[model samples]
Target: MTETQRKVGFLICLITIVLAVLDLQIVSAATVPIVRDLDPDHGVDKIPWLVSAFALASAAMLPLYGKLCDTLGAKRVFTGAIATFLLGSALCGAAQSMEQLIAARAVQGLGGGGLMSVTMVVIAHLKGPDEEGTGKGGSAGGLVAGAGMAVGPWIGGLLADHASWRWIFYVNLPIGLAVLAASAFVLKLPDHPVRRPLDYLGAALGAAFSSALLLVTDWGGNRYAWSSPVVVGLIVTAAAALALFLWRQTRAAEPILPLSLFRVRELRLGFVIQAIVGAAMMCAIYYVLVYLQIARGVASSSAGLYLLPMAIGMSTAGLLSGRLTARGWSARTFTLSGTATTALAFGLLALTTGPATSLWLIRAALLLMGLGLGQLMGQLILLVQFAAPRHQLGVATTGIRFFQTLGGALGASVFGSVLARLYAADGPGGDVSALARLTGTAHAEGVRAFVSATDVVFWSGAALMTLATVLAVRLPRPGRPEDTEQPARQPEPVPA
Candidate 1:
């Protein structure tokens, strides 16, 4: 692909990528009201299924869609995913009951899985090894994706509050249509030989395993005891199914997700780090929205407005880093510094349990955290691609997405459960069931204390980012700063 052609194709792909990410958090601000209105009598525990259902569907369908993209053309798969998103969004908007909404969300996730799974592959084709493989083009692709992820909450909140929660789904309709048209005209993705005889047994078993594990984790604390038969059953079923899935993959002629991608040290480590950091990035959105709505009594839209600062901070930092790398700064320098800063920000957030924390302090912490995170988020994938053989790029990218899904799913189950147990509310401040956990004045101060405990949750999330820092430090030193950090490096070779 020439420069002009590559720019148009990648830009169109970025729009679809943004829409996929937007769906992930666009529902966060609305979840509280959506569940309360739809299932008023149900326990808070049942609500995570709303989030997990979509996540579960997306997880199950990702490898399937990825394999299909390889078998069919990228355009066919990408367009189909967008259409699924639009249709599912309409169903969600028209849902009359919780069951209808959950079912619609599941449909939406089928398309979402495709969009999330395929963008990385689309990007790799755009940045071919024969062309400029790693540079501004590589880093910008992820930076744009990160920016999309950052804005989802703010946009979700604004739409849910200013209009109706249904608009969150409805908003995708026009955007998806626009992207389909642009991509048809501007994108120039090349063709690949189709793989036949996809591993049906492995796909089925993988989906079953993932769904069971997600359900067990999401509902264990709220709807059923963790030690109960239902949770235990799901756990055993998930383990058996997953084991079978893995065993079958090892022997299969054509695997949906090849087990061999783990052989590349940088790709494997990158995926693991992405999972840990991505979980923190995603779970923070979930909890912060809850904190603003439930603990702080802010409106759905108001929560979004406050969160906008983080988006601005992250974007500004991302663009600046891109510019810096363009000027010859080594990716390693930014990568290590960014990871360290993220760890530091989380530490500061952990100490913010008191009402006495200065607003300026909060904003500064968010800015520092965002700046550091943007660097890692933008640079890591380019490093992974550089480390992998060209033919395996699609599988390698999917591995990154899979780890991210695992981390987010794990964070949702564990973090959501812990938050529920800690904040059982007796007063008007929280869900009534949560209050029943407290006794007397201690109860009053206890919930108050726990309300301030959002910091602890934030801190736990920060620790995950700190882990990302460790892995980043272990990476083999960059071959050359120019090789992975700048667009100039792409069009021109850099000296070792």
Candidate 2:
């Protein structure tokens, strides 16, 4: 492919990624309005699923999507994913019930699972097999994703407040159609003619395990008590499924997730850090919006504006870290510092934020948090990519994403449960929206309760980040003699 084709292909992939990442943040901001409009009677109780279902479905499909990209060719799989997502978006926009909306979101996630991973694969194909190409492509991708995340909430809030909440989903139609057109006419990706047999059993086992695990998180204390038969059964099922999946990996000719990837110390440690980051980051983003809206009585659109500082911090730090890593800065240095900085930011948030706190102070904390997170986001991918063998690069990359998504799913469910329990105990028994909308003394009580509950949630986030900091310290330094040394002879390039 020529330089121009590569550029167009990269642009197309980047736009698709932006769309995928943006979907989560935008939907999160719009959740309040959506619930109010669709299920005002029991909307608060169902709010978590609006996010969790998408995350769960996306996590479940990730490993299989990676395998499919290799077997079906990136172009074919990517096109299909876009189509699936578009169909889901239309359904989401038209849905009149919470159950229908949640199911549609799952379909959207099934498509979204492919968008991020396949884009990375396609970018790799465009850049060929070179370290410089990997660094540049990875850096660009991270920046675009961060930017998308930063703006998504604001866009969602604006649409939800001024237009209809449905517009958040409806907005995807035109952008997706344009991507499809460009992908067909302008994007040129290499095709692999050889087909590998897919590990259907492994995929099934992996999906079962993830679904059961998410159910345990989602329903354990909310839908049923932790000791209830349903919760216990789900937990047992998840454990059993995990055991089977691991066992199958040992014998399958091509496992859906290659168990051997965990043998690499850097990749292994990097995944742990990535998972922690994913959990902490998701909690911070979504819960902060909750605090602003419920506790501080900020408008939804304005709540999104508050995230700008964090977004700026993340985008700036992410780009700088990527450039520095390419210039020989150690990944371990950024990992340790970034995780520590994030922990400190969360610590500040836990201690400082209250109903009476200044919005500017909260924004300042978010900015610091974003700076730390941005450094980790780009560097971790590079660390894993460098550590992975050439043949396993695609799987290794997708594996990092898989764990991260899983972490997000778990975090959202757990945090949502905590918030619900605390809020229920502190306020009158009803939806948080009703509590927030009360007048005079009742309004004050609602605000206090919301603030108190949010404080607990932020504390949990800080604790998670602190654990991530500890794990980040254990990561091996990048570019060490042992880390850099490779076989003198290069392997033949695999067909893309």
RMSD after CA superposition, every candidate: 5.4, 3.6
**Residue lDDT tens for model 1, 1-496:** 5788778777777777788888876786687668766777773545566677688888888767666666665667777888898888899888877888888989998888878667767766776555333446555656666666667777776776678888888888888888888777776775655446778888899899878887886778868889999999999999999899999989998787777656555666788887886677766556655655544556766665655556666666667776677566656666677778877877776665344445456566667767777786666666665565554555556667777787777787777766665555323346434544656675566546555556667777777777887887766565633322222121212224
Candidates in order, TM-scores: namely: 0.85, 0.87
Q: What's the lDDT for all of these models?
A: 0.70, 0.80
Which number leads on TM-score? 2
- Tell me the spans in candidate 2 whose CA falls farther than 4 Å from its real position: 31-49, 94-100, 128-134, 416-456, 483-496
Tens digits of per-residue lDDT for model 2, 1-496: 7778778888888889988988877787788888888999998888878877777787788888877766667788889889988998999999999999999999999998888877777776677544442355676676667667777888887888899999889888999999999889876665658778899999999989998988888788777988999999999999999999999999999888887777777778888888888888878888888888777778766787877888888888887877876677777788888888898888888877898878889999999988988888777777777677655666777788888877876888788878878888887646465785588888888778877878888888888888888887777664454653343123536658
| Predicted candidate 2, C-alpha RMSD | 3.6
Q: Which candidate comes out best when scored by lDDT?
A: 2
